[model samples]
Target: MLTEEEKNAGLVGRIIPINIEEQMKTAYIDYSMSVIVSRALPDVRDGLKPVHRRILYDMSAELNLSSDKPTRKSARIVGDVLGKFHPHGDSSVYDAMVRLAQEWSMRYPLVDGQGNFGSMDGDSPAAMRYTEARMKKITDEVMADIEKETIDWTLNFDDTIPEPTVLPTKIPLLLVNGASGIAVGMATNMAPHNLCEVVDACCAYIDNPEIECEELLQYVKGPDFPTGGLIYGYDGVREALLTGRGRVMMRARTEIEHTASGRECIVITEIPYMVNKAEMIKKIADLINDKKIEGISYINDESDRNGLRIIIILKQDAVASVVLNTLYKNTPLQTSFAVNNIALVKGRPMLLNLRELIRHFVEHRHDVVVRRTRFDLRKAEERLHIVQGLLIAQDNIDEIVHIIRSSQTPDAAKERMMERFGLSDLQSAAIIDMRLRALTGLERGKLDAEREELEKRIAYFREVLASRDEQMRVIREELIEMKEKYGDERRTEIIYASEEFNPEDFYADEDMVITMSHMGYIKRTPLAEYRTQHRGGVGVKGSATRDEDFIEHIYVASMHATMMFFTEKGRCYWLKVYDIPEGTRSSKGRAIQNLI
Candidate 1:
């Protein structure tokens, strides 16, 4: 509604008409793009979201929290981040910071924390005020040559300070540490990989950018989780590497042990990635209380700082393999990790497969190396110019000293030196600022040696900048150096087969004799228990039976062989030889009806 006076002033048409639907569509898209590009997804180059990048930058650049320095309070770090770069809540920033330090979360922890960060049992970390953190030694690689202007910078939230758009990390952090996040209508869930494997793959890619994903797989077998579990098969890993999306089955590492009381127990040493230990134990307890699983007698979590250990005691009559399989079927001990490698590339979300990921990292390193070399080359040239000026002064020491003494002011002396030697302002100033001791014989020799080294470096830097091959060689060398410094063995194991696990796979095949009596008693005894003896030795008892129920049937079969039973009432039952009750030569056996 326009006012009458405004209408008289011919302002009636100021309120332009537009479709409400169109406005909403436009606004919603704008907001969605904001979340997708600016907040959620990690940049493919550095493998970090905005908040993570901001925190690292503030710690490294603003606070100088290097690995060698004393740790600073996490609250102080969060405060600086919120005030300078990120304007979000303090909790979000603190959580991200804590994750960087938690070994369970990060394949290679970026921050070295001095207090409790978190645990695999899903415990929350202490408050920011109670914790202290400094950057890890590996994190120094991320901030390497940052001051050399190897990457772009953008203004912070309030435009008061500038921050890096992406870290010029030397390593393929995207693959080495992985990333996960959710944004408008899209999400990313990448799995961490072994540093050595990733570095090897990266070097191979730099040698040949046309390398296929299959070749890359030879280097990186699969995701090497920080928690160290077993990956059931490689098919999902292959698919994810080729197409950037797939799910891999993960199972806890366990072994069967016989207790002193003759009962069997299953011992779990490591669990799947990101699964909470305490919650998993609780789920197992609930399943037991609900009678969903019956073989276990009790469960105990004996995990400690040394490693993860969970003991599950089984009943005397329980089959260890069956109970273990049941647990896997019903509990988080067996889980699937979906790999969706979506990340930001040039401010747009893109799904990156293995080769694309390697290519992006190589290209980024190429850029950083070029920029760093150029920066170094410039500084070297500037120093070379000043050194040339000094060498000239040394050669004409008497004349130079005479000019300085004759000039009325330092400004006049600089002008006269520049005019006489055809030197630039920088070189002239260097000559004017030179100390008397710098003109000594030893100092002059050092100046000559430095100039010669600078010349060689300048030439090499120029060659690297002009030749792509040289740049790649440099990238390869740096990756190898980093690998030698930090690479370690893969913790997670990958099985090549895709078949579902069968409980029978855990059993061994052996010759056994099955004996049955007229009273429906059945038992299996290993053939080895009846070894041939000398003529004077007595034979072992074949079966202990009642006088009314003598042995009526005897059969020999392998432990894995299946047996079918037929009754006169037209009923049939089948069982594996290993599943039959085992008894000593003099012991009575279990009833056949109970097993069948």
Candidate 2:
């Protein structure tokens, strides 16, 4: 059924073979590049990928942050972003934006949107048009300089629209808000940080670009997640930042509240990040149904429009701490965030060590500063050139105006000014502006002073640029030293307490007796009165005969051994060797000797 051309093409493979090795190598390279560009590296300018940035940008454009207008419906913004920028579904985009706005989801949300953006209880936001949104002051300030060409732009996937290549973020978003993503074989998870703390960290980076990771820790205590849980140790944080992989434990907070009816309730104000409220409620329900918790009344989510107020009502006089400990032991009340991936280098996915992540960010900041300085210098030069030309043309205002009026173009007037004032093109343009202002004296003096200031600024910028490489080198060296000093490979997921305890109690001597039997159970008798106690039991009158009575005793020992013994009832029994079961105390009974 194949056409002649199709048949020929199919047969070509058999007739003219291709190198499979070369084809595989080419395919692998393409896959690696795709992962790096699409998943790993966040654009330096925008601090977001196409999806995230587009959502924020669309929201800003529709809501008009500068206007006193009320917030627009979130549904409308989602529709626009999905239609124009991201080709994803409206629900997905809206959900992501809603998550971003939730204070509990992010440590420092980029948008200060109003309305029910949902809660830490895992309630999904209403449809796009139902919930309203607007950009925060911080978001506007961070993105303000973007329009002035402070950053680069690249085409979107369809190559039809231009998207900002990177965010011209004044603050390092990676350190501040952090990010998490998965792509192919690699993934990244970074904890959220406080805005104030991140700002302070950025300032520290600026002041001393060569600061070490330990020194940087002075500014960033640790990740301050919006959920308000405690980070147990500093070592995990240090490891995650350095090697891009570490785990931290998080626990939910609970308070015991007593009602007028004398019933106890555990109020959970804060829950673990990323935990689903509905799921947790179901879990608690399951626990109650399974009889895992006794003396309990009800579990209520009780979350309202304002915030989370989950209340777990208990039976009257129930032990609150017991319930609390049980929740921690069995539920999502205690969880962990496993961080293992990074996004620092451009177009490459390299596993970041903590110091390396900081170093890369610091270096990127320097690059941004240099680019910004260059941009400013160019604008100053252009302004200075025009001022010089205008100053030279001040005396001949009429003639210059006549030349401007008579010339077919502005360039001809510039040429005339150049000839008449004996000025270079830049100086001529500067003088021509002064002639129009009618300032022959003050204008000339002002232009000279302005030119000198511009030169000084440019010179300063050059000096800063020149020292950047050396500064980066020094910073790298210091980070290396800190890594060498404190860099320890993580051994366990759970961070252990560092306080030392006395081992004397653990090694204390205790008396133990051994009893051997054929069946599996060890019996021990006291060592103090072995012979006397046996004689006393043997002489008992009208009691069960010694040959017919059987007995067992508790044993405590550091080691295991087997012993055979005859009961007072004349029954012979054997005990196997085994260590004492945990949580058992030794008995003070006599050692049984022989049968009757």
Candidate 3:
């Protein structure tokens, strides 16, 4: 705190002493909050960052780039977004718009692009000047009721034009297309889900707000990534849905196939979400060249417009399953996605679980529905008032016409009508402005029908405005309608993890012959290496030993079988048969101590 004299001195251009540490602390806090609220995080209700929302709004409201309209150049959209709404770099705005059009990036794309918009191989999109874009048909849901005073509006950067604080999106966009961003000290990584599942979960919550996360899981199941893959377990998914944070294992979808030459190969049909296909393939190649992973003869990337297909050919003697496990271990073929459900709630960053996200969307819809109903109700009442006055003039058509014609001017006619019919100013003005044809019998009946319909509409709108249940019903109906129109089956598959799983299951199960020398040397060879011979025929030497040592133990077991060796000191060791070193008939066996 500055004293009076010091404050006065500072105001008079004299420097005042201050703590640099305190100043730094305050400045950093303000900066971080700005980034958190204005830039990095997405709003919980709309599931859009500031940039994305601005781009969509500019395209639809400013450029009129609707689905049915011809697309405008991407550069024009980006320029309008920067000038009127988002005052950011052109690249950031264009990149965000491009991502919205990418099918592999978004579960359900919101924008339709005319030119190159990149691919799953991590290619950059063409420059804005070369591309064109328009809002997708589904984006209408996000912009619906926007012009009906359904949401609050704020001035843009220069305060010259007003923009909405948020869109009136009927869909639970936050969950349907999850968000990711990095703020000052935190980051968010949400997972996208199937539209049908998210809608089902949200509707279920609206029907039962107190529903637990466990029950919601029945509808959501798990994240349905756009790039189809396998979710290894439910533990992480359950944690994320209930606690807002967890990690799930993602693995590429692959199948073992055989070539015309009878050689086995692994065919990858799908990869984990957000993993770059070309980069993943390159990583595999690097690993193979470095000898970190072996057994692969070569790899072929067969990805095209049709679909993704990566073929990994194995050597003649290599085990296909073992090679696959190694690939998963050493490459991006198997990865883990961290779920961090962070978004802005009422202008503050918050970590929300599945149930909270659904609840927020419902509440936002309720607000928009109420506001929209109020607007509609007001409009209907005003129309109803005019319709009532028109009906009165139709009944007294000749008298009303005589008064209008006898009056010297339009103003005089309006005043005469008001006095005769006891109409309000608006009603009198409408009556005077009525065309001569409106007095005909056919037009009179049309007025009566419109009045009746307006009365019913006004009453319904009032009910919706006054009753929360009615508002929720409207929201539910709209949600179901969107689901029926846009929902799709889940792309990602979730597999339950078992606790008793063994790593050895990935190995080939075959018979092997184990041999041990009296000197405590041990080795294993394939059972096929030993040919069948008559009893009288001399048996082949299995292993070479020292001059004084001789064979002591021999046995046959499957590659997956466990072997136990007991020592004289009452200690026991267990090992899998496949873990043993394989040696030729004339080669010396490995030391037993090393084997154990």
TM values, all candidates: 0.85, 0.69, 0.92
Q: How would you order the candidates by lDDT, starting with the best?
A: 1, 3, 2
Q: Give the per-residue lDDT digits (tens) of candidate 3, residues 1-596.
A: 88999878767756677899999999999999999989999999999998998888998899999899999999999999999998889999999999999998999899999999999999999999999999999998899999989988999999999988899998889999998999999899999999999889989998999999889999988889999999988899889999999998899999999999999999999999999999999999999899887788899998877999999999988898888887887789989899999999999889999999999999999999988998999999999999999899888988988998899998999888888889889998998778878977899889989999999998889888778888899999999999999988889999987242366745678899999989888888888899988889998877788999998999999999999999999999999898888888877789988867
Q: Write the candidate numbers in order of decreasing TM-score.
A: 3, 1, 2
Q: Which stretches of candidate 3 lie over 4 Å from their true place?
A: 1-13, 498-501, 513-521, 527-556, 582-590
The parts of candidate 1 lying over 4 Å away from their true place are 1-11, 501-596
Off by over 4 Å in 2: 1-36, 39-47, 57-85, 158-161, 198-218, 232-235, 401-414, 423-596
Q: Report the C-alpha lDDT of model 2 over 1-596, residue by residue, as the tens digit.
A: 99999989888757867699998989998897676676445543234655677776666554464324567777777777766677767776877787678776765576656766775556666666666777765566446556656667777668876766666655556655667777666676777655454445555665676677667666555666666654555566777755668876666767899877878898887777778777887888798889886556888887776667778888764567767666766678777788764664666666665455555566655555667667777787777666555654655666777887897877787787677667687665554444434555665677678878987877765665678654444434443443343233321222335222223222223344554332223344433324344644763221111343333443444323434557558877654333232212233222233221
Candidate 1, residues 93-140: lDDT per residue as tens digits? Answer: 999999999888899989999888889999999999999999999999
Relative to the unseen true structure, what is the C-alpha lDDT of residue 340 in candidate 1, on a scale of 0 to 100?
Answer: 99
> Judged by TM-score, which candidate is best?
3
Residue 66 in candidate 1, Cα distance off native in Å? 0.8
Q: Is candidate 1 or candidate 2 better by TM-score?
A: 1
Candidate 1: worst-modelled 10 consecutive residues by lDDT? 501-510
Report the lDDT of model 1 for residue 251.
93
